[model samples]
Target: MTDPALSELTPEQAQMAARVRRMMLIAGLTTGLGIAAVFVAIGYRLFRSEGSAPAADVTATLPRGARIVSTGIAGDRLLVTLEVGGATEIRAFDARSLKPAGRLRFAAEP
Candidate 1:
């Protein structure tokens, strides 16, 4: 079937329309490729852990009196809850190296 829109356009107008369509297609493909590259980079970074230690020695890194209550992973950080004396402490560490980043201690109830 003939396209009514194409039949209505002059020869010059048809050429311009074709050029615009081609430009839009190129632009869309470029945008898609850019987005795909970003996602691939993110995936590579997330999964790349070669040459690093198989496991982090978390227990050895804890304080002498601290006892691990729970453990979890958050983004790039490791979350470890410890019971130190009578206080509940949340220790945050670098997930890859197990290096201590910071700690949060809950105050004892009155």
Candidate 2:
């Protein structure tokens, strides 16, 4: 409403105008927050770099009949699943250093 109209507003009209103003204020704050979040994400990506990675030597020799089933990265570890003979073997390795972290074997119950 125009300034002249607002000056002659009834009580109910004034209440509705106040509600509309409050909604506009909330919308402005939400938009401002969304913009700030995008800027922060851009700054983080530009400032953070891993630099030159160190070369790590790791060699694993699987059994004659073993074959890799799947590979994935979880957190800081690399998960390697292999079907060796009749059992399922899962090996965890440190992603950065390529060091063997742990191993697990699952066999079917006959």
Candidate 3:
């Protein structure tokens, strides 16, 4: 006995099914490509280096009688404000390598 519901599809129905399958395949490929791109971006960020080795240990020496008033980070530099001999000094160092970048001193006029 042949079941009507399980019978072969009409020509129009078969064409419609094929068109739907094609659309679904395109959508699936697009979604898969997007997910692959995301994974690639994440992998690049995780594995790539920033062209400089990170410092394992850093030691910055301060002058005698120099007291650290404040410390902060500005852009890519680390800033340290110090009070030395009644004068204020601002020192900037490279945040990555801990190298001295520049210095600023504030003094009263004579």
Best by TM-score: 3
By TM-score, rank the candidates, best first.
3, 2, 1
| Model 3 TM-score (2 dp) | 0.63
| TM-score for all models, in order of appearance | 0.49, 0.51, 0.63
Q: How accurate is candidate 3 locally (lDDT)?
A: 0.94
Ten-residue stretch with the least lDDT total in model 1: 49-58
lDDT of 3 by residue, 1-110 (tens): 99998798999999999999999999999999999999999999878957767555888899999999999999999999999999999999988888999999999999
| Best lDDT among the predictions, by candidate number | 3
Clashing pairs in 2: none
Kindly report which residue pairs in candidate 3 clash with one another: none
Residue 49 local lDDT, model 3: 50
lDDT of 1 by residue, 1-110 (tens): 99897679898998999999999999999999999999999899888946566775455466779899999999989898999887899989888887888889999679
For candidate 3, the clash count comes to 0
The segments of candidate 1 whose C-alpha lies over 4 angstroms from its true place after superposition are: 1-61
- Poorly placed runs, candidate 2 (over 4 Å): 1-52
- After superposition, the stretches of candidate 3 with alpha carbons farther than 4 Å from their true spots are 1-8, 50-58, 85-87, 106-110
